[model samples]
Target: MRNQLAISSLMGLALLAQTPIGQAASNLVFCAEGSPAGFDIAQYTSGTDNDAAEPIYNRLTEFEAGGTAVVPALATRWEVSPDGLTYTFHLREGVKFHSNKAFTPSRNFNADDVLFTFNRMLDKAHPFRVAYPTEFPYFTSMGLDQNIKSVEKRDPLTVVFTLNKVDAAFIQNIAMNFASILSAEYAEQLLASGTVRDINMQPIGTGPFVFQRYQKDAQIRYKGNKDFWAPERVKIDQLIFSINTDASVRIQKLRKNECLVTLNPRPADLPALKADKQLQVIEQAGFNLGYITYNVRKKPLDNLQVRQALDMAVDKKAIVDAVYQGAGQLATNGMPPTQWSYDDSIKDAPYNPDKARQMLRDAGVKEGTELTLWAMPVQRPYNPNAKLMAEMLQSDWAKVGIKARIVSYEWGEYLKRSKNGEHDISLIGWTGDNGDPDNWLGTLYSCASIGGNNYSMWCDEKYDALIKAAVASSDRSQRSELYKQAQHYLKQQVPITPIAHSTVNQPLRASVQGFRVSPFGRNNFSGVSLAE
Candidate 1:
């Protein structure tokens, strides 16, 4: 029952230690759910990437650990233009970037570093992006280039961003994983030597931790940045991200104290974790959503009636109860209720098999119609068990005279293939990168995300315009109304059917201290310390 809210008192006693106590072991091992796709969070959308990036880099602004409140991070403070189209950030002084065997930083973080980070994203012709042409799913998929007009350095410690139009969530967006600042000097060195690919393997940043090495899909190691700009240095000397795909293996490792912490412990294992006096569990309302997307470009799914039919035929309530094991709630709308301006009033499609059959019949999708359902390989905050969900969907769909072919690939391959439009209907979702409605609506459903996040390929001018108008205005009331209307449009379109938002549960050993689960579903070890 002890969660993040109860950890404040425990933290007060050990807040002074910049290293672990009693055991002579300053290292904190984490049983990460999955390996990061790459260190470049700007280029990926999965939480695995965020988990790795959060410790290695800092953003201008950040969502507080275990909370959604935006706080000053790399940039001490910022100013917004009157028209809300421009933002100026004051970078913190004397913040040193991490130095390792791969690359060394000759100077501290400054405006030039900030310029390199944003410019590489905003400018396709920039040498960094051009030299290392990796896919930027969260950036390009979110239509950032269209929103951000330019990024320029005002001085050594000041950076200014000019937007094409007003975007109320701009600051929160900057706090996202994709906005993690990189050392421009490091990029230049790598690009000049034709070893730019090392930037993805070895990251150099101004965060509290330093990236040591990453053994693909196995382990990612880090050490504390002693010269971090923050007043208090990182409590843990070293951090290890142990990539283990099996939930049971992770829990076993946690119980044995092999790793001080484990991410996303299966809901079924919560009882044993809480009962064991040596272990402690953290639980909170997750700011996330899980959904099933019917790739409408495919046969039968091309019909709106068929999409709706598929939506109505699947019993979400059954899947939530069975697969989640009491860890989640049936999704109300496309986004979780935690998102600001989220339209909680909108409900998912009513489960009516009779009506679904009729709808499919009207669309000329006869009985015994066959289609593929792509499941997810790894468990996530939004979806703990994609294969189970797919099976449940298969059963529900079978009752409606549809033959479903279930398929899946490795986690990384699954995302790549899904984005490439390789499936009929796929299981996918999001843990809001930023605490903004635009992070959900505009990033996931907008036509601009067609080749990336919007795998369903649902594009409509009305939906896009409403989202555009919502972001253009700084008025909360106006934006709320626009978001509500957009939600109705999303439900009408039937591109994706919302599933559930899970209550994220993480388990840590009693020796571990100061660890908390992020509402945004990220893992942070900057403040963590291990004790005997």
Candidate 2:
């Protein structure tokens, strides 16, 4: 029998064969809580729902995911101009969609759908236009509509994008599943109606699955698109995504054969899972990092000394071991080891309670000063017990004469409070959108960027300049150098302390095959199935 592969090891899948039988014969059922935050690919704003969105929608291009190759999805091939400013995509011909009630044999896949998708992203008049908050900085970091001068449909199978400035990573950005193509017909319908209810509940795409029904938190289902371009390779007939966020409920279901797969397993559940001879527990590092964020615009945190004091005081390794049960690795500085941009030269803050005490004293953090820390009621991304983690920090900081209060809010309310920059400190984490460093640094730290994700209000002009220079450069060597400099500066500033680089923990039944993990914490559900 072949050795069981770690989720991360699946990234280098050169030997995996394509099979017609696999796509038609297999059926896999899984579970996740709630539909993705939203579903319009253009206005599809949140990171959580790609599990359902990715297989239903396809991008012009695809990143090799865990590996280094740039694989083609919708676009058969593409070319970056010599200056790296223009990208022309040569679309594949004869690609048809799964038959739908609205359209049969799906109209020929063409540039018009591609044109509508990009234009919708840049259209300020659209209702969903407000979905992309100006506070999320990477919109400009990737230089979206601002850098693109025009997108012309060269032919039915060709589309060209002209940029205001050279963007070396423009092609990679397109690989973002968020850029999934939408039918011009469907887009027009949406434009006329001004509501996403129909599309979100029932989406259309050129990928492996066709939407069947969405029962809100109860379940979401999709039928295999046998006529899909890669039908033979997909090997799955149906998908059932169930909602089971409660760890105990999920684990019980997994053991009873109620679920074929599960994610974000609790630490206590690991031993029992591992001991279960009938089931398999696969472990790998996740791409997420747990960290504390301070409102730089707010008092106390505005002072670098207080931020550094909090950074120095906390015991990251202890938290990792006790809170996470050694499931995750420790973070050094701000970079994850899995990322190409991580600089080994950058080091984590030493855990010294005394140093934290001295720094707090220097900042005049009085004994009675109550610092409130914010977190969501349910654990997310890293440190499954974010509320508990906050409480731990509160106790630790108290030893250093800082009175910290831990607060929990619902996910939506927590997000709202953080965005308004009202918290003394908030516990947060991020999963990298792609391999690029800008997803973390540039998107979160750029100066007062519109739609900026950097809610901490941390800004450094020099750091911003380096990120700009890196993106603007088509030269690989020069761009890398610029990124290195930006990382170096980021370490010195100590905006958010680096937590551990996360490992993907996706436990599947032995019958489930072709399961793989993407850096973005998404599943390529098209290739997954129950081995018959």
Candidate 3:
């Protein structure tokens, strides 16, 4: 039986493919580090959610592999107005949504699908938006509704979006995972039933893979879309995502050939993985960050002096060497160096424990005051070892005569508690969804993100205004200046100390080909093929 295929066999897959199904290279397996909360990237911004939603959906545009160049996806082509406030997209013809045990699409992708998909996110009065919970986290954070005035179906193949104001990030922003096109017909039927289940579980999109089933925290299965638009189709007929939370277990499974690809192996494991002849390690400087956030709502943390003291006290180089194993660059600002308009002049605070102690004393903060330090329980592409980083921080704070108590919760609970301003300080970070600087400063530091993804709860009106003005202009020089000024506030106030940008390491079997990981750290497996 196919189920009994030998995991220990040293021979190539060509020898096993005597059967017709095997000849088609019909099966592939992957070991994902964590289970997704759900499949909707629009509702959630975590990489875990991206892992679940990305395979089943297609956006109007997408970034090229390992770079930020905008490329066409579901949309064959597009154009922008001279004013930069209007965008028109030409939809690709004959692209079919996946059909399976779930509901199927009655027609090909068109302007109506784009209209329905975006309108539900931007228009509160839309039937689907009114029928269901209408929180699109990433879209709301970007304030797309305020920026986007209207989405109109110009024709069967053409759709136009008119923005209330100019946005420099518009083109790149639309390519984000949050902007994934939904199958309008499928959503309409589900809403009509008056009980639409979680869309992630039964996602319907015009992508290359069809969602088969998901056993939460266990496995996710998919079948290749035979009606895919690409001339070169998905070479693997079947794909299985094995959920293994423990990194050691994932590495063990990969070594045993139980899985062909593994995600987020620790930095310490790089030497062994590189030495292994059976595997190929793919690592790149990711567009991501790992940092400490000071909750401005708290007493000691609210003080700028205390925040700066903490920033200066912690040695980022030590953390980088110990945690990242030299797999990344030390971040000076919130945005990673890989992103455009990154203000390199805003350097990291000097590691001076003496100055930190003196600053705390001058701020009237007593030595040895107990404060909570929250650590992340899960490993992310940006943060390889949150607990280790937290421990390192605690040791450094002690040198500054501050008593730090390390605390941790489950992955979801940690994010929830941190967002609610429940901690004095927290370990957190972000992976850029798009190449835009507004994605970093606007979504993160702006007042709009407070009480949500902005864990620090430190919102400066001037900082907000700078980013607001930055997004409003199409001029690169003007936007760069505004972003640089906005970053100056972060450097001076030290609300959130920018830490390090990781080099994401995704290891795969030697036989796996066409598997390119994006610089934004998204997983795109549509182009992948398994060979003997």
Candidate 4:
């Protein structure tokens, strides 16, 4: 029986490696961490969603592969006015949008497509937005709605943007995944057919890959865009994102040669994976932060003393030791140490359960107070094991006479519920989208981010003002000073307890080539190929 089972496994591996009708050998299967909340990146903020949209779409500008340097994508070239309020972009000519069963493009990508993409997010009464009510979380969180005066079409190939004030990170912000351009022609077709919501389900873009199909929590398939503007970059014939939430299962699939690449491998499994000759493990210091957000809107948590007490009770060192298993560093600031303007001087509250208990009692928090603790269902670079971390936190809070009930849901539901301010305290983290201080300060804690990525539901006028001043100025010294002050202020507010900055690890088959480790935690397979 054992011999027969082994033979069956060998036959399956042989079949996977064979070049079948669709050239299966040329196809790359990535063991994705979780399913995307939606295909429309503008409506979501998670990395899983960004990974799903990246291949199927292109931003006006894009971060250089494996790095944060901004470069032209759909736009061939761009210029900014000296006053920094106006910018102009020249679109790449003859770029064709993907065609599907639903709609086909009548014209190449032009200024109208750019206008349609931004207007839907900027204008509350946009025709498409009105028909399909949704929130542009990343756009609103970054305060682009307030900054962008208008996105006007100069011509078929030219577009101009007028800003209300100087924003140093404006170019980098638009390069993010949320700013991926959409097909205006497709939008019009969907609108005319009364299928506006299909825009998210059946995406059409001018990127390296065309959307084929998606089965929730199962797999998302794509075919290489033969009409891609950068034809040389699209190496693979097909791309498949095999969604797997369990790290152990993803690793097993990779070992069996069923997957070409996998993300966020468990730290404990690194040694054996490194020893395997058939696999290669890539590691890099991730630009991210894992933290516990205390919903300031919740009772008892609204008090600063209660928040401080809860923060002090948790043993961050223990969490680092167990959850990360030597793959992460203890984080003290809201942003990671790798980011510019990170204030290393700010200190985390020391672990002291006795003082926390007294502080909680003084703040009128009764003994055995019940509180809900939410854990992430998916593993992220900054958080390898949220369930273990949550369990540890529950134990620590119990020492302070607090009863923490750990709770979790599906990845999409978890994010939605947390954003709706349903959880008392939730485990959430962020990877830097752009290499700007404002990306961390403004997007996570500003008044505009209240109903979005600001899981803490914290909006401080002073902190917001500091970040505003920082982004307004282009001077490095002045921006650095203001950002440092903002970090210190965040430490004092205690809206979130920053935990760890982890080292991202990617394990792939030895045959995989040109796989770059993105600091943003994005899985981009444009230049990747499978070696025979």
Candidate 5:
């Protein structure tokens, strides 16, 4: 049945490709790496899921295309109080929300939509939350719920956010994908029809594209939002996500003209891709980190010395050479070197198997200690080939008397199990959501993120305090010092082994234009179009 479905899907794609370049010139088919978990960006944290939501939704603030600088979107402009506790946003009037067969928005994007969007995540007793229970992973991981004292609507066109404390990254935090706005009018319509859950499954937002249909693990289709406030940016008439998990398959689709753009191309394929006259490869220093998270909650790994010994055993350079193939730099800190406040003075532990073995002995760890190494199933910009990287680490650990058993599940299951502390060690990585150090240090290592993005399940009060202090201070130099201290503290704790900071490689047909590789590792097709 699966084989038949694959063939049928391929056949449909071939038909799509047959639509003459003149007739289908405005249509874009992107060979995405995987299926989105769902359309509700707030409910998930993965880039794959965010890619699905990018066109369908717009945040009050948005990171500029190809850069991390925050700019206005739904909200035309905003004001920050002198005390840094209150934020007032003036909404852009006449912004129309996308409509589906189920619900049509009677009102424009307003303060009510902002309240409904955030309140559903913040208030436990919110009507939408009560009808369809869910957790906003990114929102909670970043401590937005705790930091935000209240969200109040000043008027139909203005909204106010009062923070419990000064948040230095407040603007950048809300500009992330998880903060994509939803239409309150549409939500109310769904609630009245007793189908509130459809708000996520059938999304309605005020972005450049309108949601049309989604065939799980196959394809998703959208039409350019004719009523979009920024209609000039909606260059393409149609956008399609062709879900293809295999890197090789996506490359093949790109070569065959079945897909105009493809993501995370295998590192070995870069040279040939760049040499190809028919293709254009875009490379950028990724604001990302690939790391091996030691589940500190697990028995042997709970020991700091054991974690340090494991970190010493693996050769990050070898993995980078073999896996990334010259497309990455060795990462020595929890956050990437490109990020501000990154301490270059911090050094990684030397790769010495003998020293690692002795350290394990000193820590009272037995020779041949067994551990399960969970590898990712999908390709991310930070880690091109996680399975191969896992095997390399397994071999490196074996030399230091550690019996590493490499295991993997489907992409979604792998993340869920690892986040639930099911693995002794897991291969995971992150692309910075916003250009903030807190987005990395806070979201991944902070105490509040323990059960969510913090797969290490490790937290220390002093480390948490440092990050918290960094977030509370608006002063750059002070925040940098605090973040540096936190990095030093992380080096001593060794909860995770920093692997590499990879360069993002995006390959598309030469005919494709206006597609810029996002620093945040998301694909946005707003102003992208195809040449005849």
Candidate 6:
């Protein structure tokens, strides 16, 4: 029951030594929830706690976690066609496997590897999609297979991707690690049997870390891939990702030096961890929105005036202060400020009780119409103080003569119900998928993606048209203009109120040199090493 809020002054660079503490192994112990639960690179989807697949899988291009646009990972360099419809990538050479096998006669990564990964995503029998059905279901049926004009191997060193049309976001799509290149030779063995768990379990990728072993609900081990292309930069010799679900337990491990890095540390643990001279905290603002969504497709919420009434009734600033404890800021626009397209002209939801009462009365929800409010478990911050928000709204709406009931569910199941639009109102948080404004707006508001993550089920044809145009147009300036209009429309409608943009409260042991938390939520350890 302690709420600690203090920032440590470890702002600049610190020296690292080759040797580590305690174990001769020199492993960086990190505590987080084991997400994706399994080792299939293709199956790894976002959410949950663990960044399990990153070490074993190498994407064609990857954003440097905390850094900007895609930097070269597996592919050494690439070129675009004169028409912008095709891309040719020249692969890096001499990357050996964890199996200690010799580099194939090609001496470079090949087109066949990329082809296998894309085709495998379309394969219905694959278990990779099973790990994250909601998110990847669209990937399987993304219509990329039929639309891909062709995929040709120019030679061992080059691969060509020809699209049916000039899809500007194609590069961004490949940057998604889901399009990670697989070993054609190994994948062939799995395809012959029409199953791939065995090969996926033991992945072979050209990354800094090589998979060692995994113990379910306990740990996953990896040894450094010394022969990696960027060997000089990837200093860490090994990484041991420990699965510690309890937030308090994770913090204690950081204090005891049992773990080098602790993610999602409770806000209360910050001051104590800062007091421990051997520890530090890096607080970065993120583009994540934590809001209470009213499923407008369902009964009470189906009423527009009622939606407006609730929108006007809730005090977002108070919630941001009391619940989030000033760890985050109030959101005025649908898109988070981190996104480039967030328009500054949009207004925040004003707390107007008189307006809320009039709107509810106009909606015909007489004196005591009871509504059910849904929430998630209190473990992680999908509104740990959601009951407080619900109670506040219940009292606010009562001034307008409406009654409210509260309900809660486990995180995963709660997400499922919210997706189905089954609840009147539910609390949810959205982290940016690819650091793009389109990622936030398109996923939540695009009519095409309804019932997926667009839990509110709010629809507007004009808004949908503008979003579609923005996605298709390749011009950055024009696209930005169109999205600005789209955001304005969303603000006027208010299907979901823009709540608080929460900050990540991360704690790191002082020995954990070069450890930093990324807004993107990727566990980047490229610069990480132990203090001497």
lDDT digits (tens) for residues 385-431 of candidate 4 = 99999999999999999999999999999999999999999999999
Candidate 2 off by > 4 Å: 1-26, 33-35, 44-46, 65-68, 97-106, 126-141, 194-197, 379-381, 420-422, 448-452
lDDT of 3 by residue, 210-290 (tens): 887776666777878888888375777877787788888888877767777888888888899999998999977788999
Cα deviation at 432, candidate 1, in Å, is 1.5
TM-scores of all predicted structures: 0.94, 0.87, 0.92, 0.96, 0.97, 0.82
How does candidate 2 fare on TM-score? Answer: 0.87
How accurate locally is residue 142 in candidate 6, as Cα lDDT from 0 to 100?
29
CA shift at 159, candidate 4, in angstroms?
0.4
Write down the TM-score for model 1: 0.94
Residues 241-324, model 2: lDDT tens digits: 766657677777667666677777788788888888757877767777777777777777888888888888888877777768
- Give RMSD to native, each candidate: 6.4, 7.6, 4.2, 4.2, 2.0, 7.1
Q: Model 6, range 1-532, lDDT digits (tens) per residue?
A: 1112111111100111123343433667777654344555444344552267767667777776575477777778899887777888887776654553422323345677776666556544544434323234224222344446767789877888787765556666676656766677665555566555655556667677877766555566677888777776577776777766677877877776677786766555667776888788877886588776777777768777788888888887877777677677888777688788778889866799888888877877777888777755543433435666667767766777777787876554666677667788777767665666666777676665565667687878998888767766778888889899999988877788777777776678776666656666667676677766
The alpha-carbon deviation from the true structure for residue 133 of candidate 1, after best TM-score superposition, in angstroms, is 1.5
In candidate 1 the C-alpha lDDT for residue 506 amounts to 79
Worst 10 residues of 5 by lDDT: 14-23
- lDDT leaderboard ranking: 4, 5, 1, 3, 2, 6
Clash number for each model: 0, 26, 0, 0, 0, 1
lDDT of 3: 0.82
Candidate 3 matches the true fold with a TM-score of: 0.92
**Worst 10-residue lDDT window, candidate 6:** 6-15
Cα-based lDDT at residue 179, candidate 6? 71
